[model samples]
Target: MFRKKSVLTFLKAQVAAFLGGITDYGVMILLTEIFKLHFTFSILISGTVGAIINFSINRFWVFKNQSNYSSHINSQLFKFALVVLGSISLKSFGTLIFQKLFQIDYRIGRLITDLFVSYGFNYPLIKYWVFRINEKQNAIQSN
Candidate 1:
C-alpha cells in the first residue's frame, strides 16, 4: 500500500511538472524569439512562472495538503521559492559548464540540467522538505 501510494504521488507530481514545463518552455520561447530577450533572462522569467504553477499543483493535488490557512500556504511557498532559487542556479551554471566543456547545444544542455536537477535535487527537497507531511498532524490522525 505504501509503495503504491508513493508511486501514485510520484506519477501525479511528474504530470504536474510536465504541465509546468509547458508554461516555462512557452514563456522562454516567446521571450527569446518574439521579444529578443537573452536566453538567460528568458529562462529566469519563465522559470519563475513555472515555479508558481508547480507549487500550486504540488501543494493542492500531488501532496494533498489540506491546510488552507494563509500562514501554512505562505510557509510552503517560501520553502518552494528557495528550492526554485537553488534549482535556477544549478540549471544556469550546469548549462554553462556543459556547453563550454562538451560543446553541447544550449537547449540540450538545459535539458540535461533539468533532468539532473529534477531527479537529484528537486524531488528529494520538495518531497522531504517543502511539502512534507506535518509530523504533529500525522500523529494526531494516527491516534
Candidate 2:
C-alpha cells in the first residue's frame, strides 16, 4: 500500500515536470523554428536547461518535505544528474524514432516521446532512486 505522502509527492513531481517541460519544449521550438537549428540538436540544448529546472524544483519543492535531503543535496544531485542523462537520451532517440515511424512533426513526436520518458523512465527513478524515497522508508514513515 502507498501512503498519502507518496501520492502527494507524486502529484508534486508531476507539477515540477510540467513546469520543466514547458521551458524545455518552448526552447526546443524556438531553436528549431526561429534559429534554424535541427530539432534533435535543439532538444539536446533544451533538455539540459529543463533538467536544471526540474532538479531545482524537485530538490526544493517536490521532495523537500523529506528529512535530511538538504544535507544530502550533493548526493541527490549526482543521482538526479544520472537520471536526467538517461531521460534526455531516451527523449532524443525516442522522439527521432517516433517522428520517423509516424511521419509526424518533430514537435508532436517530441511531445509523445516526453510523455513516456517522463512517466516511465523519469518518475520512478526520481522517486525511488534519485530522491531515495524507497518503499521501506515510506512504510515506516506511514506507520
Candidate 3:
C-alpha cells in the first residue's frame, strides 16, 4: 500500500496529466483536421504544447511539496525537455504502429498509445527526474 502522502501526490499528478493530455489531444486533432497536418507531425506539435502545461502544474503544484523546486529551475527544465522529447517520440512511433498494425484510425491509435506512454514513460520521468528536486542541494544553495 502506498503512504498517504505518496497516494495524494500521485493523485495530483494524475490531475495534472488529465489537464495536459486534454490540451494535447485537442491540439493534435485540430491540427490534423483543420490544418491537414499529418498525425505524426501533429503529435510532435501537440506534445510540446502539452509538456509546457504539464511542467507548470508539476513544478508549482504536483511535486513542489517534495522538494525546493525553485532552486534547480534550470536543471529541472533541461531534464523536463528531454523527457518531453522522448514522450513525444514514443507517442508518434507507437501511434503509427498501432494504426498500421491494427488498422485503427490515427485518433484511436493515438489514444491507445497515449495510455501507455503517459503512464510508462512520462509520469515516471517527471516524478523522478523532472520535478524531483534535491532538498540537500537546495539547502546548500539557500545557505
Candidate 4:
C-alpha cells in the first residue's frame, strides 16, 4: 500500500485538481448552452478537459515521481480513468436516487454529487493509486 505524501505536495495537487474542475464546469456550461448538448454529453466533454489537466500537473509536479515515461503515463491514465468512472457513477446514482425516490430535483442533487466527487473520492484515489511509487522504484531513484 502507498503512504502519505508531503503536506505541500498534497495541497498543490488539490488546488490544481480544484482549478481543473472549474475549467470542466466552464466547458460543461459552454457545451450545453452553445452546442445544445445534453447534460450527460456535456459532462463527458468537460470531464475530459479536467482529467487531462489534473493528470498532467499532478504527475509532473505534485507527485514528482521518476519512472519510465510510457509506464508512468499508462499507469496513471488507467487509475485516472477508473477514478472518472467511479465519480460519474456517484453523480449519476445520487441524482437517480434522490430524484426518483425522494422526488428531489436533480439540479439540487448535483451540488451534493459534486461535493462527494471532488472531496470524498478524487483526493484519496490520486494520493494512493494514481501517484503510487513502489519500494524498489523509490530506492533506485534516490541515488
Residue 143 of model 4: what lDDT?
A: 81
**Residue-wise C-alpha lDDT for candidate 3, range 1-143, written one tens digit per residue:** 34986799899999999999999999999999999999999999999999899989988888773344565787888998999999999999999998888899999999999999989999898888776647775565347
Cα lDDT listed for each candidate: 0.85, 0.86, 0.88, 0.76
Error of 4 at 126 (Å): 1.2
Worst 10 residues of 4 by lDDT: 1-10
Query: Model 1: which ten-residue window has the lowest total lDDT?
Result: 134-143
- Candidate 2 per-residue lDDT, tens place, 1-143, comes to 34986799899999999999999999999999999998989999999899999988987798763456465777887888899888888888988997888798898899999999999999999977887756675566567
Error of 4 at 123 (Å): 1.1
Better of 2 and 4 by TM-score: 2
Sorted on TM-score, highest at the top, how do the candidates line up? 1, 3, 2, 4
Report the lDDT of model 1 for residue 22: 77
Model 1 TM:
0.90
Off by over 4 Å in 2: 65-71, 133-143
> What is the alpha-carbon lDDT for the whole of candidate 4?
0.76
Candidate 2's TM-score reads 0.85
lDDT of each residue in 35-128, candidate 4, tens digit only = 9986567777788887888887887787776466797778888988999878766766775677678887655665667787778898889878
Query: Which candidate should be chosen as best, given lDDT against the real structure?
Result: 3
Better of 1 and 4 by lDDT: 1
Please give each candidate's TM-score.
0.90, 0.85, 0.88, 0.78
Q: Which sections of candidate 4 miss by over 4 Å?
A: 1-5, 95-109, 139-143
